[model samples]
Target: MPPSVRRSVEQRADSVGFIAVKRAANAIAEAARDSNSVRLSGAEHTAAYLLTRMPATYAASCKVLDELRGVPVASVLDIGAGGGSAALAAHEKFPLAREITLVERDPLLAEAAREWLPAAHILAGDLRRMTTFPPHDLVIAAWSLGDLPAATVARLWEAARVALVVIEPGTLRGAAFVRKVREELLAAGAHMAAPCPAAMPCPMVEPDWCYFAARVELSSMQRRIQGGDLSYQDERFSYVALVRDPVGLPRARILRRPRHHPGLIELDVCTAQGRRSERATKRRDRDAFRAARHAEWGGAV
Candidate 1:
């Protein structure tokens, strides 16, 4: 999270107190384990999310949006925008974005988003009932759409003038949701923009799923709220980006963190043809070995 956003979140969280935020954070975590939708029914819940979850989500959003560096994103619409984390990340990625909009069901969260992004248009309503949405260059649903039906994804795709990105938890269920959306959009003529090297059916089998981890810096307040001593946390997430038109996609995407061995690095990647293992050995290819040594999970190879 940026310093400005971090300060703002701290200011809000300070008012709720540590004990209140801690309790709310635990409740929120428990609820998330059981349901797909976020439950922000009170101020404490909202404050807890801002302090504990927003930073990780923002970090993940930044990482995911980085893949769209070359894409022209003049406008962005964040559905189910909780505290405007994804929207804030979008603004950072596309500073020239002319228009920004956010849809949130929880009034408290909607107001919080408005406070965070004063220039954005905030819609305080349920996304499930919304019949239509304004078209935008990029439409993102971060940690959203897991519970929504396939028709919701179609609606979101229709509103996406350039691309549609859906992010979810890294659990098996989350991977299933992402795969479902990917197959649906690909069948509708959409092309891959990130993560997937090809549009072919996901070669990943049932036991092994596709997911990535984003490391996030934890604020002091967040550390207390989470009751953790670590200064950083790894947030696992699964996402798919579908563009309206064909784009230059990567030849292969590293599926997991590279494994370092004696003078060699092992990479599990998804290629245009299928999934396979590629090796980079210092004795064979110094350049590739150097790149693989610095390679991160979910990066292009």
Candidate 2:
């Protein structure tokens, strides 16, 4: 996250009282655990979703959008835009986008989105029932594909004229869904645009899933709601970006934080060849070592 945005989030967090926020956070967490639990409705649930989940979702969406930076985007379609986080992130990243559409099932959530994202064309309906989607320059499904079927997801990719980005929670289940979608899209001839070095099969095996984290400053409301005293929170997520046209292939993706030893920098990376550990020594490889020192997890090296 940028310092300016961090400061803005912090200021917003400072404005809300802690106790009420904590209660709302607890309720939201409980509700999220069970799919059969009460539906997200009413003002309190909407407020809870916004205060707790929106920032993390927005931060995750920002990371996904970063992969497509500099691409021409005149139109965007945001699927399952809970409180409009993805739409807001898209607008911030592609300010020139003239047509923005948001598809959300919940009327209350869709209504909330209108207030936050007035410029977007909000479509209130279940995505599963929709047979066709409007083609757009960019299509994003952020933390919204876990429950969707593979056919529906494929339709989403087919509707994208330029790119398709999917973001999911950083969990075992989320990784499984992302991997499944990645394989499906790859088979359909889409090119991997981010988080992967090449279009070859994923090298990571069972019990190990690919995921990344984005640091987001928690609003006072978010901090209090989550029962955390920290100024910022790390939102972990798993994502895949597929493009209609191939972009320059990245060499490899740093899988984790680089470890520095006496005069060596060790990196865990995923390449077309497979997952491997590479070492750069300051004495022998000064430039590579320097680049490794600055490399971040999930970034291409």
Candidate 3:
């Protein structure tokens, strides 16, 4: 998370007491474990999300949007913009973006987003009921499409002039939603942009799902509220990026972190053909070995 955003979150946490935030955090976590969307109604729940959830979500958004660095993005629209995490990440990634709009169903969250992003147009409306959205170069539905109807979700793609990104939890249910969106959009003429090497059926099967993790450094207040000993957490997320134009697609995408040992490197990557494992050794392929040794999860290989 950016420094400016971090400070803003911390300030919000301080306003809410630790006990109330902790209780709300536990409730929110339980809701997620049950694969249920939480409707945060109180200040405690809102603050809990701002402290315990927003940072990790922002980190994941940053990682996902970084892949689209070369894509031209003049404007961004964030659906289900909880505390504006995705919008903040987009603003940081695409500095050239002139217009940034965020749609949040929760009025508190929308007001909180305005505090962080004063120049942005934060709209308070339920995305499910909205029939149409203004077109933008980039449309983001991060952690917001889970409960949306298929038809409503389709409208998000329609609003994207250049690209659309949908993100969900790393759970099996979340991956299922992402897969459904990927298939539907691809059939509608959208092309795979990131994390997918080709516009083909997902190679992952029932037991395995496509997901990535982003390490987020927690603030002191965040650690206290969550009751964790560690200073960081890995935010796991599943996402699909679709673009109107297919350009600069990679030959393969690393699905997991590379394993290195005894001068050998192993990469589990998704290729155009299917999911496969690649092995590289110093003696056999020095260049490939070097690249694999430094490769990260969710990177192009």
Global lDDT of each candidate: 0.90, 0.81, 0.89
Clashing pairs in 3: none
Candidate 2 ranges beyond 4 A from true positions: 1-21, 31-38
As for TM-score, the candidate ahead, 2 or 3, is 3
Query: What would the per-residue lDDT of candidate 2 be over residues 1-301, giving only the tens digit for each residue?
Result: 3344445434433454455545666777786554312356565566666667778888889987998877788899999887778888888899999899999988877886786567789888888898888999999998887878898898899889999999888877888889999999999999989889899989988888899999887765565556647999888899999999988868999888789898899999999999999999999999998998898888888
TM-score, per-candidate, Cα-based: 0.98, 0.91, 0.97
What is the TM-score of candidate 2?
0.91
Worst 10 residues of 1 by lDDT: 220-229
* C-alpha lDDT of residue 163 in model 3: 93
Candidate 3, poorest ten consecutive residues by summed lDDT: 219-228
Full-model lDDT, candidate 3: 0.89
Relative to the true structure, candidate 3 has a C-alpha RMSD (angstroms) of: 1.1
Q: Model 1: how far is 40 from its true place, Å? A: 1.4
Q: Going through the candidates in order, what is the number of backbone clashes in each?
A: 0, 2, 0
- Using lDDT as the measure, the top candidate is 1
